[model samples]
Target: MKVLALEGQKHIKSFIDFPHDLYRNDPNYVPELYIAQHDLLTPGKHPFHDHSKVQLFLAYDDQNKVCGRIAAILNNNHNAFNNTTDGFFGFFECINDQKVATALLNQAELWLKKQGITTIIGPANFSTNETVGLLIDGYDSPPVVMMPYNYSYYLQLIENAGYAKKTDLLAYDVPYDTHNDRSVRLLGALQARLKRSNIIIRKVNMKDFKNEAAKLRDVYNQAWDRNLGFVPMTEKEFDYLAKDLKMIVNPEFCLVAEQGDKFIGFALGIPDINQVLRKVKRGRLLPFGIFKLLFGLKKVDWLRVMALGVLTEYRKLGIEACLYGLIIQNAISNNIKGAECSWMLEDNYMMNNAIEAINGKIYKKYRLLEKAL
Candidate 1:
């Protein structure tokens, strides 16, 4: 068995293709867009490379068959913000072999050690800002957009590799049709109260999305300041992400809170494009794949509430509840089947209770594992 640094196009393609074969029999596995992954891993294309660095590695067995993959990451912002020398491991996927998993993780640790890092933490697909964590719970269904899905054996493999739980991220499931929605019952009252305070909630104006996103970026930085491992995104990074999201963002589900032109808070619920991508074999979008993604948008039945927050100073003023209510209302109106309010820190009681008040069940759990170097 051997571990190889993924550098050349051949190695890079192998890294991306390994998972497709790994999860082939897993009914819930959704193949992510190949082109998007390519761009993200490519330094000049993904903005994360501008401020940080990542090195992809692939593990191969005696017969030269790919067995596992990992990305050893040095998030400069994560260290500077937390004031700790912590490197990260992400993009991990492997066969159910302990040796393969161990080799993959050991390489990541050694790479991080070389970067002067004292601890290795992750499955952060580079950082907390992207697809982070190993899906340790809720394997009954496919994951929503931007979320991860892995087999139960992964937990044992990671633990066997000596990675301990650092923290768990939560994902709430709000079934639009079946669940009793307390948010809907209280939404009228909540909106009335917010109105009294001169606060207005409205759909994002696509005509002015560029300017609106700019303001919301500031709110995002401050709103999540207290979350574990969060680092404010650079301007270029935020803009790059905004542009990608805008391509799939439904204006009705992209909402904002304002008081006299000031963007104080926002909530983004994007259609679960995975419903379409599940049919896009190999995650390719050309030929028939593009048609599946295009015509399949209308049939997407769920929305992934990827983000929702208010500035710290303005929090707990019913703003969080109001945003959630609006998201639910819009989702129901659009006939969406469900909404996933996800990747929430497990310890955030205020937000957790708010979601509970709206009948959002804790349906999935993801964990970030760590090992002291």
Candidate 2:
């Protein structure tokens, strides 16, 4: 097998399309949106490129068929914010061939080494702010919206390449019917208790989304500061992401806690659009695919509680529980069947215990891997 650093439109398109063929027979494989992938990979299209660099590689067999792909990424903001010289590898895919997997990994390592990186970690498309981690456990079900999915053998391939687990991220399954309603039942009391301290919980106002997003960004940067691989997003990056999320963000599912105009915490849940995207053949969104996505929105029964956090100074005041409680209540009222509160750090006992208190079960585990360059 030969590995080549991908360049130009044709190669990038091939990189985005390879997974379609590789998982053609897999029932659970959901093709990511083609346009979304294109903008992400193209340098000028995504805000990530303004502060980082990514090099895509493709592995080809003797007959010139693509067998694997990987991306070597240098995230300047992560290093600057965390004070570590770490690079990242993401957008990785390969057949079950050791040769192809190793070749792709070696290429990424070599590229990172040349950039003066001492250690490399990922499956992070850019940073922890985006989709990161490998689907190390729970391969039986398709990943929720914005989550990663891969063949089970990927664990062996990555481990054999001399990479070891850096950390495990947890995904909890909370079915509406089965989840403990204690949190929701006590939500009113909790909100009243918080109100005593001048904190109020309410749905995000889409009419004033721009200004609201700005305030939330401040809390996001502070609340997630201590998380592994956390990197504060620049204004442009946050706005770029907010614009995309605005397309599917439900007002009721996005809640914010405020201390009389000072935002202190927030929780955001998005409809599982994968329910529609799964049927969008090859991830295309033109012609018929657009119609399917538009009409299929209301039929989606699942939600992904992608973000929930409170500023450190305001923790333990029952704000966290209230945020979760409100989201759960909204989910039930909307007729949503279930929700996945995901990508949580395994050792986050506080958050984990809170989810467990609500009867959330650990249904999936994803991992980040690292190797010294």
Candidate 3:
């Protein structure tokens, strides 16, 4: 097998399409949107390229058939923010063949080494801010929106490649009926308690979304600063992501906590669009696929409680419980059957315990792997 640095639009197309072909027979595999993937991989279209560099590699067999693909990513912003000479390998996919897998990983390592990077960590499509980690468990069902799914054998392949686990990201399944209704019942009292402290929780206001997003961005960066591999997003990067989410965001599922006029925390839960996208063949939204996505929104029964964070100073003040409780309450009221509270750090006991308190089941686990260069 031979690995080559992706060069042209043709190669880029192949890099994006490889996963579809790789998982063609897997019923749980969900095809990510083709246009979104194209734009993300293109430098000018995505804000990530404004401050970082990514090199795509495609592996080919003796007959020149694509066998694997990987990306060597140097996130300049992350290095500058965290003070580490770290590199990342993401957008990785390979057949069970060790030779092809090794070649793809080697190519990425060689590319990063040439650029002066000393260590590597990932499966992060770009960064922790985006889709990251390998799905090591939970193959029984499809992933929720913005989460990833991969072959179960990938765990063995990555470990065999000498990558050690850097951390595990947790995903919990919370069925509405199973959740402790105590949180929902206490929602009113909790809000009143917060109000007594000059803090109140409210749905994200859509009419003033741009302004609200800017404030929430600050809370996001500050709240998640202590996380592993954490890096505050640039203004442009935050805005770029917020724009796409705005299209699918239900204001009711997006809540914010404030003290007087100061934003203290926020929780955002988006409908699992994957419920619709999974049926949109090859991730294309053309012809009938577009209709499926548009009409399928109302029928989406699951929610991905994608993000919930509070400023450091505000921790232990019941803000976390209030945020989570409110999201769960809203989900129930909307007829959403359940939600996935996910990608949590395994060591985040406060958050994990809070989820556990709500009776959320640890249904899936993902790993972030690392190797010294």
Q: Model 3, range 1-373, lDDT digits (tens) per residue?
A: 7899977565888998999999999999899999999999999999999999999999999999999999999999999899999999999999998888888899999999998999999999899999999999999999999999999888888888889999999999999988887777887888788888999999999999999999999999999999999999889999999999999999989999999889999999999999999899988888788999999999999999989999998988888888888888888889999999988999999999999999998999999999999
lDDT of 2 at 366: 95
lDDT of 2: 0.93
Report model 2's TM-score to 2 decimal places: 0.99
* Residue 152 lDDT in candidate 3: 89
| Model 2 misplaced stretches (Cα beyond 4 Å) | none
TM-scores of the models, in the order given: 0.97, 0.99, 0.99
Worst 10 residues of 1 by lDDT: 176-185
Candidate 1 lDDT at 155 equals: 90
Give the whole-model CA lDDT for all candidates, comma-separated: 0.89, 0.93, 0.92
Question: Could you tell which candidate, 1 or 2, scores higher by TM-score?
Answer: 2
Where's the lowest-lDDT run of ten residues in candidate 3?
A: 6-15
